[model samples]
Each structure stands twice: as structure tokens, then as C-alpha cells.
Target: MHPLVRWFHQLGSPPYFDRFAARWAPWCHGIGAVTMAVALWLALFRIPADYQQGDAFRILYVHVPMAWMSMAVYLGMAIYAAIALVWRIKLAEILAMACAPIGALYTAVTLATGSIWGKPMWGTWWDWDPRLTTELLLLFLYLGVIGLYAAIEDRRQAARAAGFLAVVGVVLLPIIKFSVTWWNSLHQGSTISLTGPSHMDASMQLPLWLMVIGTHVWFVGALLARARADNLRREAGKAWIAETA
Candidate 1:
């Protein structure tokens, strides 16, 4: 194996991951928090009102970012699951477990805020659009992961099984992304993209970006903190606990 891959597998040990998570998690979360705060405050009061949606349009900022995160996090979960399955790494399993709730939260936020935005734009809160349907499915998928783990007494077996589901669920993500373009829907096409933002102006774009960063910060902080807590609980009788604690 390559040096980087070997390093990653070794780093999957609980103690090493816990220590590294301790350091990097705080830094990512802190920087992400600062970034989000600056972006949100500026967006809330400074940006000019939308000529169409007015102040209610502000919710779009939050909605879009969370929607993006909903998809991104599912992909992240898949990667973590793959790591656990291929490497048989214990920390990788826990980390995969850690990501589910965070991903679910983003999915929930996406649906709620999308509803708030929809009331004015579409005359209804929901219309069974592909994006909404797929996102709902995504949330169910997260719950399924959590449930699968919870139902099992054996941690490793549970992780492996749930990890398989996570990997398979990612196949649905692209269908959600292209659903707007592929089918007729009230939901708008991608505003933010690889080649600069498409529809959302910088004013709308700015706050949405901030919310994304904030969500990311929240994801990192919550996951690592949970991961650390899990490590402590699971390693209650291990030698490292006595040494570290």
C-alpha cells in the first residue's frame, strides 16, 4: 500500500483518531464558526432586499445551504462507510456512526426551510418534488443506519452492515441533484455551481454560503465531540482510559 493509505489505516485506531480529532476538530469548527458568523451578520442586515420575495427571501439563504449539506453529508457518510468496510477499522465504524445524526439534521433543516420558502413561492409548503422526496428518503436512510446499529449487540457486525447501506444510499444522491433539471418541478435549478453561482445573486449567495459553513462547523464539532464521548464510553476498561484520563 501507498504511504498515505497506510498512514490512514493506522490512524483509524481509536486512540490516534481520538487524539487527532481532539486537535483538528476544534480548529475546523472554530474557523468555520467565525466564517459563518461574519457571513450571516453581513447577509442579515447589509444585503439589499430582494425585489421579488422581500424579507421572506432571507430564508432562502438558510434553505439552500442546508439543502446542499444534505447531499454532501450523505457522500461523506459513504466514504466513511467504505473506510470501515475495506479496512476493518474500528474507529472508522464509530466515525460512520457519528455522521448519521448530523446528516439527518441537515436533511431536516433543508425540508423545513424549503417549506418556509415554498409558502410564498409556490402557494403550498410542499409539492412532492423530486428534491424533497429524495431528501426525505435520505433522512430515512440516516435513521436506518442508526437503527441498524442500535438493533445489534455486536458493534463490529452492526457497523459493517450499516456501512453497506450507507454506501448504497449514496447512489441516490445524484438523482436528487439532477431531479430539478430532469423533471418539471417548483424547485429551482442549482444556483451555486462549479463555474460560479448561476442564479442566486451575490447578496443571496453570500448568506447561503455562510449558512453552509456554519452547518459544516456544527457537523465537525458535534461529530468529533460525540466520537470522543463514544471513545471514552466504549474504552471504559481499556488501558488507554486510565493513561489518558
Candidate 2:
């Protein structure tokens, strides 16, 4: 096996993660910052607004990516929860715990931007649309995990509870994914489709993809840094952790 594989396995042990984070966090920060800058330039200025929607369509850059990330992050949390539950890995639990708040923030951004765009396009800000409603519920699920984690004092106990919450939350995700298709809604159908045909042009499509890549990278940076901090706090008294510090 590769030395990096060995390093990753040791990461579940905490001390190695701290050392890894100490060396790599700065790089992650730097890259994410640069990526954000490039994404802003591409999304805000280089990419022209829609022909029909005009300035209103600009919201899609933020809205679409956040909506996608919110769901993607939740799915990730569920996977981490499963890993923690099955393997009894502290690192996985902490990673799942760290993912919830960020995921919630992304969900909020999705809803808020969707609302902002809706006012101009649909002539209304709020809707009982299945897609919109299901996404809102996703935000609530994120908050539930965060709150449940904080409610308990013991880290192990808290993680187990949060992990369980995340696992249960997984069932709601398919509902979010299919909500637009399954029910009537003021919201338009998906811009990008799995089978074929993205309802967007190259001018619009390029920046949106850039934003997606940038955010996924942001997710990695955030998850790793937060997971590293978590390991530090949990492994506070260990000889290796101390030596690593």
C-alpha cells in the first residue's frame, strides 16, 4: 500500500491528522481562496446574464451550486455516519458532525437565492412547491443534527446521536431529488438533466460548472480542516498529539 494510505489510516488515530492538517491546511486555504476569486470573475462578470431572464438569471450561479452542494453534503454526512457506525471510527463521526452546519448554510443559500430569483421571474417569492418544500426540510435536518450533537456533553455519545440522525435523514434526500418531477411547482424543471439536455447555454453553462468544482473543493477543504480540529480536541492528552503539536 502507498504511504499516503498508511497516513490516512493513521488519521483515524488523531495525532497523524493534526500533523497532516498543520502542514496542509494553509495550502487548502490558499487554493480555495484563489479558486473562489476565479469563480467570482467567471460567474459575475465573464458570464453574461440570460437573454430572457436578464439579471435575474445571475442568481443561478449561486443558487444552483448551493442547492446541489446542500444535497451532496447531506449524502456525504450519511455515508460518514454509516462508516462511523459500522467501523466505530471516531474520525468518520467527527467528519459527519462537521459537515452538518456547512450543509445547512448551503441549503439556506439555495432557498434565499431561489427566492430572490423567483420574485422577478415568477412574480412571487414563496411557494408550496414540492422541490422547494423538500429542500427547506433538508435545512431543518441539518440543524437537527447540529443541535442534537450539541445537546449532549460527551463527544462519543453526541457523535453517535448525530450519526443516527444523519442516517435517518438519508431517506429524505430522494424526495428532494424527485420533488420537482413528482409534483407541480412554480419552479422550473432541472437545468441539467441526467438522461440528456441541460436547459442552459455555453455562456451560462461554463461558469456554473466552475462554481460547482470550486464549491466541491471548498467542501473538501472545510471538511478536512474541521475534522482535523476535531481530532485535536478529542486527542488533547495523547502523547502523539502533544508531540505533533
Candidate 3:
């Protein structure tokens, strides 16, 4: 087998995964922390206030990253769910289930920060804008998966059920992405673009990118840590757990 394939197969083992997560999770957390700290400092102190929104625009650094992660994590969870359902990969199931709480957290943060940013700009803390509404739906989907997973006594069965919900919830992602364009939204359109020129000045864009990168890295660490704990619980009383303990 190819080295990469071999490594992947080895990673499917609960014990091996436990060791791998333990070894890597801390590094991811540390890197994410340092990067986010620098990003926050630059966003808060170094970057000049927006000509239009003034200092209130600084919240975008926090809001945008979490908003991006909320969707990204959901997509990731759905993919993992599909893999687990098709192949019955226990690790994939664990990973899919593990993603729920983290995704929900990011989604909640997105909503909260968006509300905070909106209070000054839109003169309201809440709105029924298409973008905001769909994002709120995404949070509910996450909670549904988490709640469904916990409701069942059988871990594997619960994962499969919740995983199915996650898979089905993917339809909401694009709607959320395109809501501003598709509807007359109170929220602003996306300013940053991957392929095209961004609308914001380069100086302001720098910390936003840093925050995005940091949050993604931090999410991986959090996912692995959560999955590791779930893996241990599922594997309790097994020979590997005994030896590892």
C-alpha cells in the first residue's frame, strides 16, 4: 500500500488515533492562539478605522472568521457523515458527531458578533434578513444533530441518525451563501473574494486573513480533542485503553 494510504488505515484504529490526536492537538492550539493574538492586536490597534463604519468595523475580524467556520465545519461534518454511513467507518462517525458542538459554537458566535456589529450599523440587534435567517437555521441543524446523537443509548446508532440529519442539512449552506444576492438583505454583501480583488484595502484585509487562518487551525485542534474524548469513551474496557491507561 502507498505510505499515505497506510497511514490513513492506521489512523482508523482508535488507539492510534488517540496517540495521533494527543501529539498534534496541542501544537494546533498553540499555533492558532499565537496567530489569533497577533491578528486581534493588529485588528484592534494597528489597522485604521473604517472610513464609513469607524471602529465598529473592527468586529468583522471576529465575525467573519466565525461565520466562515460555521459553514465550513458543517460541510466537513456532512462529508464525514457520508463516509461513515457508506463505509461504516467508526472513526468517521466519531468525527462527524464530534463536529456538531464545534460547528454550533461557531454558528452561535457568528450570530452574536453579527448582532453586535449590526446594532450600531443597522440600528438593530436582530433582523430577519435572508443571510441571518439561514445562518440561524444552520445553528439549529447543528443542535439537532447533537441532540439526536445524545438521545440514543447506542453510540453508533445515534451517530448514524445524527449523521443523516447532517447530510440532509447541507442544502442550507448554499442558500446561506447566496442569500444576500438572492434577496434584498439588510446585511452587506461579501467584500472578500478568493479569485477576484477584495473590496477592502490591503491593510485592513491582513488581520482578517490572519483571523480566518487562525480559526480554521484552531477548529482542527478542537475537533481532534473532542473526537479523542469520544473515541476513549467508545473504546472503554478495550485492551488498548487498558494498556494506554
Candidate 4:
């Protein structure tokens, strides 16, 4: 078998995963912190103000990354949920459930920052724009998954039920992504594109990309930490738990 496949198989073991998470989570967190700090420094002091919005545009450095994370994390959660549902992988269930709160957090930040940014740009704190509305629905879906997981008495069953909801909610992602294009919305169109040149200047774009990369790495650390804790709780009284302790 391939080394990668073997490593993945080993990762499936609760004790092995616990050790792996413990060893790597801190490193990921440290890297995320350093990257975010550099990004913030560049965004605050080094980059030029927007020609139109001025310093207010700096919020995009935070807002855009969180907005991206909100959708990206949900997509990841849904994939983990699908795997858990089909394969009954306990680690997948833990990961899917762990992702809910983090995704919800990113969604909340996106909305809050968007509101702050919008007030100056659109002259309103909130609007039922297509992008905003679908994003709100996405938040609700995240909360619903979290609530459902907590409502059931049995942990595995709760995970499965919540995972099912997560899988069903995958439809929201595309709608959120294309909302501005599909409707006459106040929100702006995409500025950055992987396949083409970005609309923003290179200097302004650099920090935003740094923040995006930092946040994703931070997310992995957070996810692994949360999953490790949940795994320990679920495995209470097991031989490995005792051994680990």
C-alpha cells in the first residue's frame, strides 16, 4: 500500500490521531499566528488606501477572508459529513461536528464585518441582498447542525443526524457564491480570481492573500484540537484513554 494511504489508515486510529493532533496543532497555530500578524502589519501600515473608500477598505482584509472561510469550511464539513454517513467513520463524524462551530463563527464574522463595511458604502447596516440573504441562511444551517447534534442523547446517532443535515445543506454553497451575479444585488462582484488577474492592486492584494492563507491554516489547527477533545470524550474509559492519560 502507498505510504500516504497507510498514514491515513493509521490516522483513523483514535490513539494515533490523538497523538498526531497533539503534536501538530500547536505548530499550525504558531504558523497561523505569525502569518496573520505579518498580514495585519502590511494591511495597516504598508498598503495604500483605496482611491475611493480610503482606509475603510482595510476591513476587506478581514471580511473577505472570513467570508471565504464561511463557505469553504461548510463545504469541508459537508464532505466530511457525507463520508461519515456513507462509511460510518467515527473520525469523520467528529470532524464534521467539529467544523460546525468554526464555520458558524466565520459566518458571523463575515456578516458583522460586511455590515460595518456596507454602512459606509451602501448607506445601510443591513440589506436583503442575494449574497447577504443566502449567507444568513448558511449561518442558520450551521447553527441547526450544531443544535441537532447536541439535542440527541446518543453521540453517534446525534452526529449522524447532524451530518445528514449538513449533507442536505450543501446546496446553499453555490447559491451563496453566485448570488451577486444571479441577482441585481448591491454587493460587489468577485475581485480575486485564480484563473485571471485580480481587480485589486498587487500591494493591496498581498495582505488579503496572506490573511486568507493564515486563517485556513488556523482553521486546521482549530479543527484538529476540537476533534481531539471530542474524540477523548467519546472514548472515555477505553483502554487507549487510560493509556493516553
Q: For all candidates, what are the clash counts? A: 0, 0, 0, 0
How well is each residue in 122-165 modelled by candidate 2, as lDDT tens digits?
A: 88898888888999999999999999999999999899998999
CA lDDT for candidate 2: 0.85
Candidate 4 lDDT over residue span 107-170, tens digit each:
9999999999999999999999999999999999999999999999899999999999999999
Best by TM-score: 3
Model 4 residue runs over 4 Å out of place are: none
lDDT, candidate 3, at 149: 100
lDDT of candidate 1? 0.83
Clashing pairs in 1: none
lDDT of 3 by residue, 1-245 (tens): 99999999999999999999999999999999899999999999999999999999999999999999999999999999999999999999999999999999999999999999999999999999899999999999999999999999999999999999999999999999999999999999888989888889886798999999999999999999999999999999999998988
For model 3, what is the alpha-carbon lDDT of residue 5? 100
Better candidate by TM-score, 2 or 3: 3
Candidate 2 TM-score, true structure as reference: 0.93
Higher lDDT: candidate 1 or 2?
2
CA lDDT, every prediction? 0.83, 0.85, 0.96, 0.95
Model 2 segments more than 4 A misplaced: 1-5
- Candidate 2: give the clashing pairs: none
In candidate 1, clashing pairs total 0
Instruction: Itemize residue pairs with steric clashes in candidate 3.
Output: none
- TM-scores for all candidates? 0.90, 0.93, 0.99, 0.98
